[model samples]
Target: EGAVFIPASLAYLIGTNIFGPLAYKMGRSFSSGVVNAWNELSIPLAKKFEHLLAPNAGWGFAIGMVDSAMMPIMGHLVDLRHVSVYGSVYAIADVAFCLGFAIGSPAISGSIIQAIGFKWLMWVTAIVNMLYSPLMILLRNPSKKEEKEVSFNINIKILLTQSKIKE
Candidate 1:
């Protein structure tokens, strides 16, 4: 069970290296969409070749690629829109991420697994993942609204006043 995620971790490292530059060239949303498309496609292929290690590895790789690429896009968007309160934005995002992945996903997946079993769940999730790619590709970066620029200028003067401390 734990061993299965090794391929995903490796793929994440590789995807980070590859997509960092690609994001700069192609735009973050588009790059993310491409990686997600890879992820969406990998599941069916893995289902088809369920007996092979390679297809499962590919599925892991694709998942890693999507995660690696999509994770930063949220931060980028937050920075663009909420530069003043980016810290708060990040905190909220972190909580949401933890809740979704750690709690919601497992709970939902357990129910889904019980209801339909694992094989159909993969297919269903793959279709859902496929649906998101088009939205990512079509996403237009929002134009940053002009805000009153805050200037950082500090003038500090320390004056030591000698006072009688001892009487």
Candidate 2:
């Protein structure tokens, strides 16, 4: 049971990667509606089928299949297309997917809470969250925190070594 559960959980985790991009491309309403529909549809489908078909397992399977299919296609596109074109397209898609997941998850939960009292504010925030993706796309060369940290570490090492030499 535990073994089955772990794999099912992992599949669900991997599935999100595929679904995230799909959701971004499809728009929120379509993406969410499809997912909801899938869940609803599965109940009847699972009963008719003899095999064990968990929702989480289904999600994971779908995600894995889609990602596997995408990687090969992306590779071919990269090989055929100009580097900049391929890179830009991939970067935009990646960023959009990340932004959707990062922003959308919390925003949805928070918006629901806000809607209980501050309905107008909730609407405003929803708009802002929707706007964030375009702003992210526009700001292509944002500062990378990891690079900054690495530079800081290097500087600190140099300063420490210099101080030791002076001693």
lDDT of 1 at 60: 51
Candidate lDDT (C-alpha), each: 0.58, 0.51
20-91, model 2: which lDDT tens digit per residue? 555334432323323333443443334433333465465455445444444434444455443535776667
For candidate 2, give the lDDT.
Answer: 0.51
Residue 13 error for model 1, in Å? 2.2
Residues 1-167, candidate 1, lDDT per residue (tens digit)? 55655665676677667766566456554544444445545544553333334444555555545555554666667766766556666677678867989886778889988999766776666666667766765435665645544221111111222223332
lDDT of 2 at 71: 40
Question: TM-scores of all models?
Answer: 0.63, 0.36
After superposing candidate 1 on the true structure, give the runs of residues whose Cα lies further than 4 Å from its correct spot: 27-52, 70-72, 138-140, 146-167
lDDT of 2 at 45: 38
**Consecutive 10-residue window with the lowest summed lDDT within model 2:** 28-37
lDDT of 1: 0.58
What would the TM-score be for candidate 1 when compared with the true structure?
A: 0.63
